[model samples]
Target chain A: MRLSYPTNIRIIKVPCTGRVAIIHLLKAFEKGADGVFVAGCLEGDCHYQSGNLRAKKRVAYARRLLASIGVDPERLAMYNLSAGMGPRFAEIAREMTAKIRELGPFLQPSGRTAAPQATAA
Target chain B: MIMAKAKPLEEILSYLEGFQRILVLGCNGCVAVCEAGGLKEAEVLASALRIQNMQAGDRRDIQELSLTRQCDKEYLAELKDKMDNYDAVVSLACGAGVQFMAEMYTEKPIFPGVDTCFIGVTEEQGVWTERCQACGQCILAETGGICPIMRCAKRMMNGPCGGSEKGKCEISVLVGRDVDCGWHLIFERLKKLGQIGRFAEPALDKDWTLSRDGGPRLIIREDVRP
Candidate 1:
């Protein structure tokens, strides 16, 4: 892919991408993240059984969420890489950085448009 | 069984800050999947409200309830007598469920305590994604089981919107990431099937009329009628 992303792209290395909750991604967006990405193992090569699959499914779900609120689901991504694929990790980071550049900084609330300011109780 | 979670402590706190008597309500369905505002959520919100009230010296009434479902008539009917007791409600249910509660009890003020994120599954421990947009049109057969409507940044039924650069969304004006456009997924599938030409089939315009648009929709089956 022909793209470059900002260095602000944070890499959260987890034991397994499958363990990354949707809320974590939403929180990232809520806190004003422009984009989010998850790197996992190849289908048959996951360290834990099907961790990559789980991560992929989670990514797909989140992608749609990003789209629903107009941020474009492409902002959230999932990729597969083995522990030794330093190249793959770097590639993902580079690809993500490029995408974020195209997408620019996040605008509006992360998940949903800000609700009409609720009156303080 | 998809689990849902509630909003952070602060989101609800800000909404409830001005109310004098706040009622925290929970549902037993989908929202309970990730613990957003199920019974546990109600308790947590109740406790949090007390803490906030003490801090502010507002001392809101802060009543609590975990109904079978705030979306159902029978379940909401259970709240009639209890409704008159509180000034407002802090709901932990999905938006529809919360609205049903408000509709059933017109006098009580209602507020959503959880954001309805999406119609998705728990792919792993905590990850939920855009599985179904409820576009009222489903075309999962042509592509691999992956849903283009929900996963694609653009809701293009056929092909990726012009924005897909490298398996990511071009719309990311904020955090530019490689475009893995939804069409990219469909293209990958067609490549596997050796039928890239099939992209010409026009995806019918989605009909959202079947969704929440009709306002206060209800479905009752003859077999399940109580």
Candidate 2:
């Protein structure tokens, strides 16, 4: 049971993954989260029957939405695991942190960090 | 409910390119039930637009508002006081609602955010099929409650022409499934009820004046008027 995740990773708990609406995920990105991932119960093992399944669909939709607006769809993800899989949870956290690191920091809305354009002499 | 589908983000973005501040309006009517232009959809759109503008290093103020019903004048009037806050309004209602908004707010630009599909019923959670064409005459009793005018590709009242085979309509091939022929469905339903003989009774020529052919027909009921 010796494991650690990135210091920057923050987790928000919901009653069920199905309760994680598409707007909630998008709000994370709008507020400048580099990446977001949903960890729900394993497929066919949802406590509320199809709650996890609904979360899967919502995650997919959020991915498409991000892609449609020119944002990288890879910024969002969905993972299914049983409640007892503590190792899997840590693994997912590590994976998401690594992916976000590779993607680098999200730029501010004021265009301050944009790439330098060459000017004619 | 009036079914509709969201317009592509690129198209919506293009429409808003000229404006810095915009209102992405939603309707809590048919579009709400269809999950097309509902409050959730409006919020999603607003967030997407914000993200888009943020990434592009530009400013876009998108206010999301969901009205009771955009098709109704009383509901649209609620926004009359605050209409000047934005440059234009992107309507997330059906075509009729969009047109009505345009008519109501003649001074402002109104853009449609969804494609009005059909007058239909939800078959399942995410599936909707056309049910009524508003053909102006009610013939559902004779057709076993299945409307051939809307279901049949040809709109044939007396149907199952040469295209019907194996209980599937000819156009089913193009639609990617074996759609049951309209008349075939009638025949089966009537046969089960021991009323198959009704199929032979020719339906008289329908009145075209009551339908769209009459040039945007209107109904005025003196009995209900105040």
Candidate 3:
């Protein structure tokens, strides 16, 4: 089955979303990702027991980290779906893409505007 | 260990605002075990600062370094050559380490990244409780190995006080937690040890001058001096 998501959305897979530390999420924003989200295994079905649950907590912490730095916490999100749920992944990709569109470009550390999806293309 | 908590990002950011270069100095001593000012925490703070600077459209060169022990002059001297490379330092050490860094780098602005919370022990993974007050006098032997000066709300030498009830301190009720009464703990432990009769000896008033009231006391053991 060939499932297609928004072109603006990029996916970076990991062994488990638990591996996604708060620093990684913040680094994404620092490197000019206007929006970032984590897609973890379903809440209780993580291959490494409680890995997804830990990811959920990391997502919450990342949101607080974003808010602390004056960035909109809404730009970052967490979604959980089993590996068989391709439609769910596509759905979240579309959802997060729309959110970034609403947020537009973020400010870069060099006092320059980050290139948005359209500008990057 | 001296337990501490990271300062709010906003407060820490306020210190770095307008500074182009920053050094996040971390201590791997008591603060590390407390999960407040370790190398990992220093890196986290640095990342947060970078993100914050990016959001604010400002540039900052933030470096993270964790010393073996920031309170020691030898460990601090390791950074002497690199100290001039930054505009300011955000020390993630205990109050003592922060002061030592300030004294060592007189020209560089030093800011605290963590608030020195208390002299306590980790009761569990995330819970810490005060265990000592360093009152310049030891009375644990009399109190069944519990220091009332640290555990007691009022530092009572002999008491559960009039406000104690149900073996809990009144301050505990106000703080929305059941804090064990220091005197009650003492009495129970002494009774358990068959030493309750030793309570006949009245405890003398603690000398206030020996504490912080005298403004930073110092102990010099000349025999141990190198």
RMSD to true structure for each model, in Å: 16.2, 5.9, 3.5
Query: Tens digits of per-residue lDDT for model 1 on B25-83?
Result: 98988887766778866765575455345434454687778988777899888887877
Quote each prediction's TM-score.
0.57, 0.92, 0.92
Candidate 3, residues B140-179: lDDT per residue as tens digits? 8888998888888888887678987889888986899899
Please state the Cα-based DockQ of model 3 relative to the true two-chain complex. Answer: 0.60
Candidate 1 residue lDDT tens string, A69-113 = 445777777777676766656667777767766765555322432
Q: Rate the local accuracy (lDDT) of all candidates.
A: 0.68, 0.83, 0.83
* Model 2 segments more than 4 A misplaced: A1-3, A108-121
Predicted candidate 2 versus true structure: per-residue lDDT over A1-121, tens digit per residue? 7777555666787878878888988888777777788888888888789988888899898899888888888888888888788787777777877776677656543322211110000
Q: What is the DockQ for all candidates, taken in turn? A: 0.02, 0.62, 0.60
Which 10 successive residues of model 3 chain A have the least lDDT summed?
A112-121
Best by DockQ: 2
For model 2, the docking class works out as: medium
Clashing pairs in 2: none
